[model samples]
Target: RNNQRHSNNDARRPPKTFMPTNGASRTSRKELLDLIGNNPGGHLDESSRFKFETKLRAYANTPNVDPSDVLFAIGSSVYGTNISFPVQEQTNGSKPSDEEEKETNIIIDFDYMKAFMKDVFLSYGVKPVHAETCSEVLIEADRRGIDSHGFGRLKPIYCDRMDQGILWPDKPIDVIKQTDTTALVDGNLGLGLYIGPHCMQMAIDKAKKHGVGFVVVQNSTHYGIAGYYATMATDAGCIGLSGTNARPSIAPTFGVEPMLGTNPLCFGIPSDDDFPFVIDCATSVNQRGKIERYAREGKDTPRGAVIDSDGIERTDTEGILKDMVMGKCALTPLGGAGDAMAGYKGENISLIRIELFIAISLGRGLNCVRTKCISVHHFKSDDEMRSKKKKSSWDIVK
Candidate 1:
């Protein structure tokens, strides 16, 4: 939902070269076989499998290779790595042609890919732990085939946000409130990527004791993936739920200007295995990423994603931007434009998100007051009550 990073870079650029080849290119049976054979474990871990795949697609559009030929070539090489062929005998009982033999060849080097991504994140001023987690999340998404939220976003997120003060390096998250099953976190203008995970951990601990725990936070920047926070609870044997309010970019049904954010909700339920049913998605039918995707594939937007200056549905990219920035055209909710298409449901969810944001803000205020209170007359009777109460050391806002 947060496309603030890459979507604006075209206005000032070094005219970078083409993107790298993606794994989606027609992968040969041979390559799959080689990868399978060489990596007998089958790229199954969170970091090795999913994250690696996510990084691959990002490479496809980077400034090193032709996007068109990369996938195809990689696919052919894949076929060479793992395919089986039936040999034919000539009158002389000859061997198969090189083309047939090529179907069983192998040609990828994974270490280089890892190094490439590492260099990229480090260059963006990401703290080592943060960069590692970011890379893992992206590649894991790719491996799981969720290309929509993978490494394709890494460069913009770390580098661009650092420039904007949206992502800070090594800033400690300030905790403003804490209780048994609930707390409020002030990110202190730090990266939500780090603060979010920390907050979720607090919730997980509380849930272990109270059956359910929830934490609402504010002033946190965009966390890369919502699933990352929700899954933390499920991983610890409890159902996990996490949601965040983002900068406004989505329009409520029937409204032209953006008022509600593309607020995301994520739920994680643990199953028998490691692959839990974790759903991470935005409230909007289509997000800023989807818009950029249309521009990337040279395709038109689907109906209902955006409206023009005249309040009519439109697919033109420039027009979409005009409506987004100047024309007051905004993104619709999960349902289509009107009540007939379930637009009301989207509005209902928006209200829920708004309530969560408000609850967190209010809760923080209450906690701040509690920090400044004392036992008063119980401690020193009437004499202590007459003295002016000292201000709380942690109450920065007051």
Candidate 2:
């Protein structure tokens, strides 16, 4: 009887399906939609959607299990039952495949990641305050799902440059010129991730006192994300605007060689709703970072987003990265390659963003094009204005 009972238990044991795999898992559109509960209203925006898909694919590929199978296992475990799955046999003591090795990733806590980044910056002589600020900004990008601008950028964009002595850490931001409501700053070639918040804060302060503020920074490195500075003003009950010109990578409409940065224009406005109104994007059809992301994932950029030297649209992700840096490829404008899509309009917008700071300073009769800029505007609400008027009139009569 005891032998028979043991046999029955063995017969009912669930088979293991989990196995190490060689390649990164790819995600289907169907799986993505399902993860979001198939709710149209819950669909992610373009950038967020790409990030979500990328992360999902990375996770799915990490264990080399079919996404559905993973889901099935979870469901079965939740319902207190074991599901059987066929297991692949592997040779004893076999080394992990190259693809599997490449797919492996270490999962770290958010705080630990920030601490590590902080140490990296500190080791390079960044000021304690600046190091914390920079680390927070990068981590915030990851938290907000903007992976392209987040922690992933620390090495390539900031630290590596610092190590090469190309990026100066702990440099003072000098005020080259200033008025009650406007100023010109020189970043001393320091990390813009640190300089950006400082300049925006100066603008916000001036706006509170003078109703508007305009601050510009010259000789600055790439600021992490333009929207971050813009939202700073909105947080302070003011309208915020920010933009920057990068090393040129965009070609004007009907032309092939690069002449414009994938210049971004960002705006933030206070609202009565739960979230502030914010608009932030590159004037190009797609930002270059997205292409880098596609290349990292071994995927092609969407069709028509870039053109090679031959003036032909290209989708070769890795090739495009090489070509663009060598000036053999160019990003399209917001409307895309040609006039049928009104690409010229996007070209016009790009020019506007670059010219905005120059024009504003020029209109104020200052010939200072050396600095990139940000602006802030504050206004009194109608009710407050009415109340102030009533009080002023009463005081005048008295």
**Number of clashes recorded per candidate:** 26, 1
TM-score of each: 0.61, 0.67
Give the root-mean-square deviation of each candidate in angstroms. Answer: 15.6, 17.6
Q: Which structure among the candidates has the greatest TM-score?
A: 2
Candidate 2, 182-266: lDDT as tens digits: 8877787888888888898999999999999988776678777777877888889989988776666888888888877676778
| Residue runs of model 1 more than 4 Å from their true location after superposition | 1-118, 321-323, 354-398
Candidate 1 per-residue lDDT over residues 1-398, each given as its tens digit: 11112224332443322232444432432343354346533332334444335444443334433423333332222211111224445577898688764433332222333343454455555577765665665555554545455544544455456655665656776667777766766665565555666677777777788776766655556565677666666678777776655555666677766766666677778899858888878788887766755654458888888755466877786568656756367777889566778876886585454423332334332111101000000000001112133334244233
Give candidate 2 misplaced runs (Cα > 4 Å): 1-107, 359-371, 375-398
Question: Residue 82 of candidate 2: its Cα lDDT?
Answer: 30
lDDT of 2: 0.65
